[model samples]
Target: MYSVARPCEVRWVNLSQVVGLSTLRSFLRMESHMSRCFAAILLVTTLVAVEVPAVPALPDAQVYAVGVIPDLRGMLQHTSQALGAAGKTLPPGMLEMGLGGMLGDPGLTKLGNGPILVAAGPGLLVPSWGAILPYADAEAVIAAVSGAGLLAEAAPGGVAIGSAPDGPGLAKRMLPALDAVRAGMPADSDLRVVVGLDRLSQAYLPMAIAAMQGAASAPGLPAEAAGQRKLMLGMVAMLRTFAAQAGALRCDLTVSASGWKIDAVQALRPGVLADAIRPQAPSTDRPAERLGAGDGPAVVQMHGCMPPRIYEAMATLLQETRRDPAAAALIDESMVAMVRDCAGALTGSFAMRQGFAGSPMRQLGVAMVRDQAKAKALLDGARNLFSMGVLADLMRGMGVEMVFEPAVRHAAGLPVDRISYRIDPAKLPPGQDAAMQAAMMPTQEMALAPTMWVWGSPSAEIDAALAGPRGAPRLAAEALGAGWDLYADLDMALQMKMQFALMAKQIPMFAGAFAEVPCGHPMRMAAALGEGRYRLVIEVPVEQVADFRNGFAGMQRGRHQPAEEPETPAAPVF
Candidate 1:
């Protein structure tokens, strides 16, 4: 068996395998059992040894941060022991048929797990994680084992997992990067992320600029290309200045069921664009009450800010980007138009839910739009470019006719889930009855008119469908479980691979040399600030956290391909 020079290491004989394989064989053959007595006579016993290491705790942050402490050695040892014990009891002919070879060299399994430690700050201002594998130390042991021919019988080539050249030098290079992440970080910060930002702006940014400049200066370029190039150059300049001002950054976030908000603070010095879009006092507006016919819409209604705060912030940013008088004038005109026509003070959603209770009958009411007159005026004025009289007449027709009540209860014996669809008329100012008739005409299953009385119980045809498919409920439960698992696996794989790919591009050699990459489990929630480190706290939904033991067992079973049964021994040649 291969052995490393760990003086204080303890070796554990898998007791179950020893009894099931070795003792079972001994009991079957008297001579073999006697041979073991000779082996015991020749053997020399030594003192037992034990090695243990301390486990580190995670950092304390004000908000929320996930901590990861991976014990690579322990994991490898446990996995190897399990595999070794399971491999010992193969049938007589199976070992000769390369089944033993497929199990791998249990004797040569002397590798230790490389542990990783990660500490994060609240909301991911700066977080650092690092691992150092003792690869250089393993080379010495490998050389010794080969010279002594220890593993020649066990595994001719020996197990060469994660064998890399210049292991010490590569590790030396990486350790500095780990240290650098913490060096300049604020001691006050619970977590810190130190990036090679000078390289990003001063090096990569210039390279991009040069490439773009070459493209712009190329011959036979279109006339408008020059203007586009100039604009791009201006944008790049703004970015460079922005990067310079943002020397180091920190972020914090607040998350709730409603949504999430991120507040990022950057250490800044003055930049041209920064001055242009300096922060202003937040606006004060009484939260506008839901404005419309008071709960009169039949189906669904929603009211909120017409232009959200994010849109306003974007407009401000766009205005700052205008660097010339003509550009400023164009933006001003656009803003004026937006405020006058598009940017309504309040917006609402209204849908009239009208159907026969227990019948496939439905009627869509008018939009129940507030400020309908103002909307009519805007379109009416625009008709001069085309024709105003027709639109004005149609608007008048819409205002006069339809009225929906706030709430209408359905009759009993209806399915809980119901479908509703809108009726679109080809011609404007069509009568309500005409519109409703057109909507139901395609189906020809229900007879309904666009009248006040629409909601009712399900019709006989629909009632039969609701009562069908007894197995549907059970099938749905199974589907939901399977769907959740499939989606969770796919989501986890995709997200991790994407992040790894990004990391690999920057550090090719170190990342590309990995033997087997580990994909961590999915996170329920995560938040990020503009082009910065993703702040994630592990909040796995209870339903999604597969039981640790069961999941591991399932994975093991999944990976193992089933082999044919061993042939029975011949019946002593009859």
Candidate 2:
């Protein structure tokens, strides 16, 4: 018999001394069974004790996005209800299958309602990305997705999946960053995306600069090519400087049954670019409010200040172009000076409006002036250059000649110059002269005052602009009241109808799809810019949402229709 060892004692025995051959075989089988049972128990206990691991930090990563779903089941139910309300529904059993089933893992339906992390890194070219997904049972998930050809590994409370060779490793490395992002996520945010702008600039700016420099300095290039290369190099250099002072850009999105909203901010380091973008005190007199409330099919209005850095960059680029003899011959020093002076005289704050009135489109542009005398001088210089036939000479090779006629008119007690242009029919293609003239703008008018400069197409539109705001304002006024820097509203249905009518012959599908679109509400957009951040909100009303769904369904059905050829192409009425 073999002696068993006590806690503090040791003992050894030969196999023959321990047991007989037949008895030993029976004992070996029993021992093997017991070992397997112990391993099974250990695995169960370990899995029970496993807690979700902290997301790994990826400091070198360039982009990171996380989508937090507090209750995936509830979100899915809400989405289904919303679709039903809009007269749409998903295929039967789609929700039960879950996203995993769509991805070739039907058994991976039991996912944890936690934040999903996706990240891409340091390398710009051939950048690698990884995703981490929380799971109710990591082992079960791994087994379910085993045949999906995805690189997946079990984490503490989730599964890490990656793009190519060793994707799981990348996913593991990204967990810490995900944890950090979660800590800072907004309470109501369903999604957050972070872009490491500075890191990107640091990694790729030098390479871009070097490449542009080489191109600019290359020998035997044409004069125009050399000038263009130099201009591009200058612009890239400016962008590098601007990016160096730029930090990460973060955007958070909040979704609800009503609509979705996104807030984005970019951190700006202390630099000239930051100063240029710094928001100024609110202005009492917004030019956009002066835009006429036209009874047109569509209208667009925008008001914003041009950054000083943009003007400086433009001047620098123009100077760079002048260094090349061929480019200088085309854009003389006087022309450059005139452009620079005109740009400098403007106070940066400007407003623009465009209205689509049935056939012809009308637009008005207004710019606040710092010095009216300087602006007038610049305008006079431009007219002199035009009279010298500089523009005509430039367009001569293109089978076109510009004929300019200037007439002075009065609007709101200011002198408005009514200018019209007629093409020289002799220079036009033989049979296309009348069609070309029909497409040209009939007239353009401009008015310069002490405080502002206004210009637009057609005399009537100009008069409306001169006559300040009418009775009540539309959605754009509400945006202004909320302190949005810029606002735009467009009648999507009207635009779609116009586009379809214009292209019905070439694209027969559009005509059929247009019939399905109900008269929908306008789409509205509002944007605000501050010292270092920008926020934009685009909203389509619930009514318009339904319209879009029906329109999309119609388009799908019309996609298989054959095209019809027309003898005469539809001409645009202006």
Candidate 3:
């Protein structure tokens, strides 16, 4: 019995061991299969990670921009140095500190500089906009943004901040557009903004048309409402044409120590407007050449040629006006003919300058004449028209009594037939009549020269023009040399001073405002037209920026001040 039990036990143990070994072998096979699957997944994820871009693609938008600053600290330093070279005074490292404070993160200087991507699209009420900013340390940027009370999210190689909550998703969508814009960006460009005019017009034009049509068709409109409606419709049609023909509007900005400069271009697609703007033969007669070099700096100056389309529009409006009884009575067919003739006589080029020298105010205008005889005839017709009883009554109705007369003057051995306007003191406000009369004694004077039409406030301005150039004007040479279609140089300080002085004479509260306001530097603008595009360049000086800041501060102070009681006039004598 013992031998039989031992043999049975041994057999049971051997069977159990064999079963256990079989189970262990099955488990090992299963583990090996799972390991193979894990390795395949690892390979796929590694490939995807390598393929993704550092910056996410930008989503479709109506507007997109990229601002590249390879070295933020270096740019700030260079700007500061340029400002110093341009004679602008600032405390050491003030610009950097100011920018850092504005962002609420001084450590921003440590971030790796990279291209910034921005995008915007139409929204229900406003526009939706977002930006993706590059960063070396995503954690630090996220922390800084959160500390500054802004929304932040981690991106592929940077941080995303935007108006929406899902900034990371937005960054991913913008990646493609960001890549495209970066590839096309000019090497020297610091900032470029692109506007999809077609998309914008599509989104906004319907609302605009509906609103305008509603207004135009409203009941109880004026007698001239029909003509006004036509004009409005015409404008809308033009805007539609512009949108259909224009690709995009691109504006580039470059900031340096000298000043801030912006260049905006609108490229036109093949269309009627493009054909109209095609380049023509250059004209030898430039209007800026006619302007006389003043003794001192000019308060304001402008030179440009009116496009043919403007004249056509004017003619159309005049025709519309003639159809209305009330309008026709005010602007008769004969008057329209005279205006047309005057416009026809002009070569389209014109220049104007206003200064405060040789008189309280010196103003001059020069228009190149295509037909001197026609211009002279129109001048006579204008004088007669102004002297007519109808025009006299019209002026009287507006509290202005104008006396028009013809006078002959000689300047630089040239006879000038001048038509001058004298204001009637009786029509002016009491106690201010004499001052007003003094301010506007030689209100207007016009003369038809052999090659040009000259006009000015006082006779002295005409004399200066007839005497020829005293010295080179400030911006005339530069504008003409560059063949700019439009140019303007305005001394904001002088203009404001003149305006304030005039206003103070009538309004006592404005007496010391001019003195308190800081002086601004001259602001210059230059524009040119190409075959299928338009270019505009603007330069805003640092002094002008300071002036604007100070002006706003003054306005804020005035807003908080207590209101003063309105002065009661003395009882009128019986």
**TM-score winner:** 2
Badly placed stretches (over 4 Å) of model 1 are 1-111, 116-131, 136-199, 222-320, 323-574
User: Worst lDDT window (10 residues) for model 3?
Assistant: 38-47
Give lDDT per model, in order. Answer: 0.27, 0.53, 0.53
What would the TM-scores of all predictions be? Answer: 0.27, 0.67, 0.63
Query: What ranking emerges by TM-score with the best candidate at the front?
Result: 2, 3, 1
> lDDT by residue for model 2 over 1-574, one digit each (tens)?
4432222233554432122222222322332222111111100000111111222133745344333444455555555555655566676446646765844445335667676776655444544566677785666656655666666777755887766655566666666656666665567666666666676677777887787667556665533233234334444554554566766666666555654455556666655445544444455445655565555645455555554344544455556666655355445566556656745666656666655665566767666677899878866766555445333344332233334444477888888886544444444333333334333444567887787777777777677767765422355324424545555665566555555544444445555655656543665665554555445556544445666666666656666666555324243222
Give the C-alpha lDDT of model 2. Answer: 0.53
Candidate 1 per-residue lDDT, tens place, 302-381, comes to 11112223224334444554454323422343432332442232121211222222222322221112344543343233
Residue 163 miss distance in model 1 (angstroms): 16
Which lDDT tens digits does candidate 3 get at residues 1-574?
Answer: 1111111131222322222223223322332222111111100000111111112122365343333344466557656765665555678778777766644456356555676666666555554566667776667666766776656777765777665554445555666665555554445556766666666667777787677667645666443233333434444443444456665676666667656676666666655555554333345555555575765557767766655443443444555656644444445555555555645666656677777753467777776787888767766655555556344444343233445545566666666654333434344333434333333324556666778777775777777766664542567324323545667776776666565555444443434444465453667776666665666667767666555455545444443344433233232110
Pairs of residues at least 3 apart in sequence or in different chains that clash in candidate 2: 55-175, 55-176, 56-175, 56-176, 56-177, 57-176, 57-177
Q: For candidate 2, what is the TM-score?
A: 0.67
lDDT of candidate 3 at residue 71, scale 0 to 100? 48
Give lDDT for model 1.
0.27
- TM-score of model 3 vs. true structure: 0.63
Clash totals in order: 24, 7, 10
